[model samples]
Target: MNLKGKNVLVTGSEGFIGSHLTEKLVEIGAKVTALVQYNSFNSWGWIDTFDKNIKENINIVTGDVREYDSVKRIVKGQDVVFHLAALIAIPYSYLSPMAYVKTNVQGTTNVLEACREYDVEKIIHTSTSETYGTALYVPIDEKHPLQGQSPYSASKIAADKMAESYYRSFNLPIATIRPFNTYGPRQSARAVIPTIISQVLAGKREIKLGSLSPTRDFNYVKDTAEAFIKIAESDKTIGEVINAGSNSEISIGDLAHKIIRIIGEDVKIICDKERIRPEKSEVNRLWADNTKIKQLTEWTPKYSLEEGLTETVDWIKNNMEYFKTDIYNV
Candidate 1:
């Protein structure tokens, strides 16, 4: 499955990880069509930040993934489909669970159906660590029982199952790339890493956060993007669910302090009640067993947590204008 000359369609190409993956696909010489959610602003999200030369090489299409005709139209003639579009904010899901179902579940069904109709060579479906809510065991593996502690995670769980069913029922060439907390440039302020970095860069000595006890296995966005490519290129990955992660865990409190140290800031952490999730809804821990991805494809996390955080801090510092540090995003 050589991808260099193949046609690739990346849904959610305007977003954080999707933008990175789309750029990587372009660098690999793939004919790329990026599907960005349509808006009145005509904004391509982070794709709008690309240089002229890079943007020139891409065919950007505006359409909502929830629309079947829109998805089918963009999916035509594509050799590979990377389905990354979804409503991913956890808190917002609590406020609007049906939105999650509509976008995540039904939207993913749209991708799978369109790809099946188009007979795309391969489809890489994105899954999240949140689906494996508070780990029942250490270094969570693909075999771990899924616990949907939040509406966002529940929706993702349904999406993953939808992809699985497509593979089984329709023989769709699909693989699920489940990534643990991916963080880096262009990540929204709603995410923890950006939230912490944004406030500290805004000269806040006191950083407000949610639960500090929850542990997570964080992967840099670049590594996660590479995982998608590797999976797409691997013949062994079809009908598989592979985990992309650093395979190391860090508590939220420790992670915050590590970021503060990198920024050379003397910061005090405060527990914001408003930021906390309902007790049962909170995923207390997440650690990834990345053995499957490493075995099935040529992929490994290239950035250590400290190195990734340093780069993220640098990005947030320069892009501080994009963040509203005075308000809790969500």
Candidate 2:
């Protein structure tokens, strides 16, 4: 599973975590085919932000994962595949659940089937902590029961199960990497960390947020990217669902306060009604039991929460133009 000269296809290379993963793969001498979600603008999103040398190492393909032909075509001749393309906005999923099913579920099926057809070396299916919902127990393990509290989480749950079935039935060299809340540079404003960072950077007196009591285990983007590489390089990870987390967590209110302290901003926290999820659908807590990934691979988080958040705040402050600080995104 050495990636020194292997061809790796990253399905959502234009995204936040995927962009970081692509850079990490290229650093280790992997030939990367970056599949960005095709758009009329012809933009590569965050991938475009990478340095010239890194961009040169990548072969960019504009394609839609929902289209089997496009997915199949890009997946060809690739030694490894990292499937990450999907509609990831939770609130938007509530409004358009069918879009989630079409992209997350059907798109994953297409990738799995294509991998089986091509006999690829390995395929790492990207997953989320949302699939585990509000964690039935603290430091939730992979065995924790999945409860779909939101449409987005439900879609991911279905996608995870589909990946499992593929391994059991076709015996595909597929492993699922479920990352917790990953935050860093180039992160879209839809995520909570970015939301707070952008507002604080904008010098807003009142920071608008949803429910403040929900807890989340946030992993740094760089750490999460390394975990993907580590998992893919280990034969023990095949057909296994591995977690990428710090095995630590913070309540949303506490996280916000920490960020405020880092940013040195005196902003009042305001509970925005429009920003909140439905009462029954909110994920109340999440903490990762990263024991499985530890047992399977040489992967562990290298960044502390404060260190990661400080870096994230600095990045957001410098790139304030990318965020709509006044708008509540989805």
Instruction: State the displacement of the C-alpha of residue 278, model 1, in Å, after optimal TM-score superposition.
Output: 0.6
What is the Cα-based lDDT of residue 258 in candidate 1? Answer: 92
Q: How do the predictions measure up, each by TM-score?
A: 0.99, 0.99
Model 2 TM: 0.99
C-alpha lDDT score of every prediction, in listed order: 0.94, 0.92
Cα lDDT, model 1, residue 22: 95
Candidate 1 residues 1-330, lDDT tens each?
A: 889989999998999999999999999999999999999999999999998888999999999989999998999999999999999999999999999999999999999999999899999999999999999998999999999999999999999999999999999999999999999999999999999999999999899999899999999999999999999999999999999988899999999999998999898999999999999999998999999998999699999999999999999989899999889888
lDDT of 2 by residue, 67-184 (tens): 9999889888999999988889999998999999999999999999999999999999999999988888989999889889888898899999999999999899999999999999
lDDT of 2: 0.92
Clashing residue pairs in candidate 1 are none
